[model samples]
Target: MILHGIGLVLLAVVTGTLSVLLAMALIRWWDAGRGTRGMQLPQGLDSSLKPMVLLYRDQRLVDATAPARALLDRLSVPEDEWARLLQWIGPRFPEAMEGLARIDRSGRFECLGQSGTGSATLRLLVEQVDSGLLRITITDPQAEYAGIVVDSMSQQAMEEELDLLRRSLDQTPMLVWRQDAEERVTWANAAYLRKAEGQTDEPIGWPLPRLLDSPRPVPGAGTRTRRASLNQNGAVFWYDCHSHPVGDQVMMFALPADAAVRAERSLREFVQTLTKTFADLPIGLAIFDRQRHLQLFNPALIDLTNLPTGFLTARPTLFDLLDKLRELRMVPEPKDFRSWRQQMSNLESSAATGHHVEEWSLPGGQTYRVTGRPHPDGAVAFLFEDITSEMSLTRKFRAELTLGHAILDNLGEAVAVFAPGGQVVMSNRAFRDLWPGADSLGHALACWQNQPETGPGVDALGARLTQPDADLRDSGLMASPQGQLLGWSVARLTGGRQMVRFRLPDPAQQGGSQPLLAASAG
Candidate 1:
């Protein structure tokens, strides 16, 4: 009876000790539930250091840190309750369920999610916990795969957009290429291949230098644009390239610029031809650009304007050029020095409309015919011709005419000159006094003819004057108003003109004058 009682006492002591240990275990579990820091999770949880959310095994949201809640809000997921959050995440990322399966099987996994519009992306790392809950940690984007996560539901739309972009790049007339950091071509569009001219089989994955006859190194980062030429099937082509760096790759956009190069070459050739032509021409040629600076000048321009070629090539303005000409007495002097600039402005305005022409008569008896013509691109060209010889000839001709008038004025006999057209060209004053209204300088021969008089004198004079091969002389007397005789003679002159003279006899010598007239006619 004593041994049994001892065993009962020991049992009671052991039962009390067991109850106390069980109570302590329950308290520790409750502390852990309240987020005790010292308690370690199965996945080595960093809950306090990073943003994290805990999910129950049934895919229900349980607890989240403040940062995790903010992150969930940013992802546009519901944070109000577990059921609502699950519903939203499941529909948006159907793969999350698949990721959950992976986590259940593998104990740890990752999930990627994209917003509807594709702007925001969320990466969630899920780990199985000792408490049978899913520990989801939001990791940085730079971890494994560097990209944004977008919903695959709109993947078709995104693919369509990418295809459109590709088509646009392909159909473009320009050349496009994607290259690596070593300037090795990884891809080229149709335009770029066409420019290759079938010289190479395929240029993909080849050094960019091998694509050209004499390839140069790719431009450095500082110079992202450049121009180069290529020889394709014995023909030359030019290109302009622009580069954009994308991480380790470079996007190269090139344009076929053969046309521009050819045009520039043609322009240079044409200019050279023009320069040679102008070099031989006597007329002075000067071209000024829109800024009125002298761009081109021929040798004649220097000679005519008396300006040095060095000065002209220094690029003088129109006003400065004209002032230089004035200083050298090559151009006419301006009456008002202050208004000369305004005149130059007017000159340019007029020249632009069409052409402005004027004769500049200098004080040194020199004349210049200056023509200002407008050219394309708002340029102006001036042509200058020296007309000193023409002016001198004109002055000499006028002087001879005046001398002839003076010589004819002093003659006493009544004389008249008739042109080949039977027009009375000139007559002495005595002829006007003798014949009242006949051959008075401007009258035609018809004005003086007296109704085709049938006298021998008239007949003979008409044949000599009208017939080209007739005799050169005709002289006779015609009856005057008072039955007196007036002697007249017609003779051919040098220039197909007829000279006619009339003689009036004195009364005492009237009988002898008739005999003299008959003798002269014979």
Candidate 2:
């Protein structure tokens, strides 16, 4: 019994010790798994994948893996732009998050951050060494790359604008051109090269000095400038070509002085027509502007002034011309010119309402009756009428009256007097001699003279007056009492009077003077 009891005690002690050891081991295992009894669990686990941190200058955002947040932080967006940037890039790069997740899954993530403000480069670098420890790296692109993109866009816009400007210039009516910095012609519009006066060549991009030089046909004295060239073809004219520096090149534009000139041949023909039609218009016709500067002169004015066409340029002002006239003894004096201009001004002012006339003296030994009137615009027209012919005609008519009455009484020609109503008042001695049988005063001579076909003398006279542009003067020829054949001429006068004269035909053959082609049918 004592031996069994001792074995039991030993077994109990063994069981208790084993139990304590086993319990200690179980506690150690539990402490190892859930931490020690007094120890605490870690706040985070050491894993291959970890959330990434995005950082700007002072801004930071914790997002998915490094690549995902890296792209956002690469934009270098401000804190305020966080939500906006995510919204913008999310739809734009839908696979961007997936890429970042894969980097996390692969245990290799790149860190992204803004290196400098407004930079396009994304700084990327590996922040972790372990493959599964959420490796992080930084990604960065050079700053010049952003500048290149901006410059490219600006160049594109500039090219488009330049092209539009060129097209606009080409479509414009006025001549337009462009030159490079080297003064070389870069572009010219179509109108700039077209022949304004039917010339066969284009005139654009010509050298600065060459364009201004006078053509070979140009008169040296007529050229107004040495810097600019002058070329004229009919109505085409060019002048005042001047160059000015623009950037590195020069630009120039000019107009021909003869641009307003049409062919003078039409004007010359008109002058000739006027001279033929109004042969008695003794006074010259001229046109002057509001400033009393002569613009045009008729043939008579040209003759009277004896001035060349260059008078417009040489004598720019009327006063200057008046001074020249006085020097040449063509005008009286400067004072007279002043008075004439004053009167002309008054006439011009009045001519707006009606025509005006005045009498003025010339430097020569004559006076002119000047009439002035307004044109449609600011121009004034002048007409001069010389009364010298009318005065002479009046004097001659008075002297011829006495001779005319005597000739009418004794001539043995049929004569008749009529009032404005065509009533015959009396017959002449010639009528009494020829019709001694009947026919008294107040008889209408139409009874015999109108029917001159009954007379042989009247019948033969009709054939001679058949020429065009000639007046019918006689019916025929008849022998007088002295056995001399008389041919009659008739003509109408200014008033209601007709005159008839008789003379021998072929008087030269008869050793006598030729009879005058008398003025008849007065």
Candidate 3:
């Protein structure tokens, strides 16, 4: 009885100690549940922890945190619908459930999802915890991959298009260039460099404004201006430049002025057409310098003067042609020709008038209606037309009207008649006046006529019989007793006889040189 009683007392002591240890363990576990920072969870226990979720089903989704409400609104799901989603999500939730199962079995899951009109992917995971419920994680993989693809495609297309644009720009004829916001040239085509035309030894990368003495201003983001330049050789050109903001740089496009080129070409064509129109005109056109040197002579002038075409190129002086005229007996005399040419040349140099028109006595003894026009640069133009045929017609008309006898006897025009033997048969009042009572009528023509046998009158008569258009004039002493100075002319009458004219000095000046004589004998 005493041994059994001792064992029972020891058992009571052991049982009491076990109860005290159990109570302490329960208190410590409760403290850990309240989250003691010092307590470390086991590895497998982390999968069981759950976030503390506060549910308020009656509250509007708008009342939730911005992020949470935004996510819900994007899905077009209301708060009540989400709160009661367990029944409505029967179909779509299966896919989410399957993904969760796989995550629980393998610690991670990846699956695709179709949300509204778009598609997505989910990477869900269930993490283990030491003491809490399981954690469910979801992420979208489709959105991430889609963003990467879009960025890659945009970069590739941009590079391809830029390559094509660069090639096209190089092939263009006009210069093209681009500049940064700071007005620094960033790029240019091959034609852009060619415009420099090797004059510039340095590379062309600086701003265009820096190259000119006066550059146009480039205002920022407003109205713009452009201008053109002329080359050293009198060539015209154009440039168009603009400035605008483009990201961190200013974009500028420069091109030569094509419109200016077209305008110039059109103007040149117009001038060419005008010159061509006048080239074939009928009247003689001649251009002369201040020294009476012929600068230009149209085809008509060449033919009328019997001048060689080469004379047009060399532009000979009036004296040159006058010398030839003297040799041909076309001038009254070489001295007279020289004097008259000098007078015309002097008139041109003095700029006596801006323009004038008058009759010209050609060395050939032809009367030409001429127009003289003066230019600011000391150049002159002479236009002429022959009126000899018109004068002949006028005389013929007078003869038909029975006015020839009256004109021959009373007209102030000097007149003389030559018999077949070269004797003077009759003379007019004007002719007697010129000789101052000299007995010319019914006398030998050689007594008063100047160089009766070998003078301008003889030469003119010979040419008139052979050549349809012929003339002569000369200054020489008369073949008379006194050898007086005389100017003479000869023409064929309608009946085929010869009518002559003689202009002599008055008796008051018979022994003196005549005042500067100006006469036309044709």
Instruction: Pick the lDDT winner.
Output: 1
Best by TM-score: 1
> Tens digit of lDDT per residue, candidate 1, span 342-420?
7767777888779799888988888999999999999999999988898899999999998888787677567888888
Q: What tens-digit string does per-residue lDDT give for candidate 3 at 293-404?
A: 8876667765555666775678777667646645554433425656767765654544436667656555655766667778656677777667667667877997875665
lDDT of 2 by residue, 402-453 (tens): 5676687676566544333444445566655543532422233333345322
On lDDT, the stronger of 2 and 3 is 3
Q: List the RMSD of every prediction in angstroms.
A: 14.6, 21.4, 25.8
User: In candidate 1, where is summed lDDT lowest over 10 consecutive residues?
Assistant: 147-156
lDDT of 1 at 376: 95
Instruction: Judge candidate 1 against the unseen true structure and give its global Cα lDDT, from 0 to 1.
Output: 0.70
Shift in Å, residue 157, candidate 3: 42
TM-score of each: 0.54, 0.31, 0.29
- Model 3 is weakest, by summed lDDT over 10 consecutive residues, at 48-57
Q: Select the stronger candidate by TM-score from 1 and 2.
A: 1
Clashing pairs in 1: none
What is model 2's C-alpha RMSD?
A: 21.4
